[model samples]
Target: MYYKYPNGDEIYNVMAVYEAHEVYGIPRINDDEGLELRYFSLDEPIEELNPFTEYYLRKAGYINKW
Candidate 1:
């Protein structure tokens, strides 16, 4: 999926959804930056989303609006 920032930047292939209230994936940055499994909630808005998680949720049809 695509991740968008409030500053108008974007990153792609950074996420995937497999179940309710959770998202599973990692941002594909430089290999030196490494990777890890990150989580996001669909049950409620997250205050520290970097703004991208919500955008993904909405774009993927998991949410209608913020």
Candidate 2:
């Protein structure tokens, strides 16, 4: 998935695994046609994701330690 800042100055291409069971309780992968990109609003609360996803994003420099 690719996340681009509103200013277009920063962009991040993150590689994430498709987990069907995590999002949906199905055992098989999702069968979709086109690419789907989801954007979050600043007012929206952030949801907790899998540890692997967070690790990769952090390692890729998309996130910084405080």
Candidate 3:
């Protein structure tokens, strides 16, 4: 996905999916209407992940920056 900001700045899309499995790169699910996405996710927690909570955030290994 890709889009230009209101300021007309063209930007690459990026999304950190909780489980960026090889199967999760569908061009549609992460595809937004106007914005782009650099989609990504984990590969091990597909069955153990909780999308309704921050389980992904912590397991994503970026909690130190949080």
Candidate closer to the true structure by TM-score (higher is better), 1 or 2: 1
TM-scores for the candidates: 0.38, 0.33, 0.22
lDDT of 3 by residue, 1-66 (tens): 467899999977555545443554346444455564344343334343344334546666633343
List lDDT for all candidates, in order.
Answer: 0.64, 0.51, 0.49
lDDT for each residue of candidate 1 in 1-66, tens digit (9 for 90 to 100): 676999999987656567644434663556766565445555667666656667777878886645
Q: Total clashing residue pairs per candidate?
A: 0, 0, 12
Residue 8 of model 1: what lDDT?
100
TM-score of 3: 0.22
Ranking of all predicted structures according to lDDT, beginning with the best and ending with the worst: 1, 2, 3
Worst 10 residues of 3 by lDDT: 40-49
Model 1 worst lDDT run, 10 consecutive residues: 20-29
- The C-alpha local distance difference test score for the whole of candidate 2 amounts to 0.51
Better of 2 and 3 by lDDT: 2
Badly placed stretches (over 4 Å) of model 3 are: 20-66
Candidate 2 local lDDT, 1-66, one digit each (tens): 456678887666656543232253323435685464444322333376556666765577654642
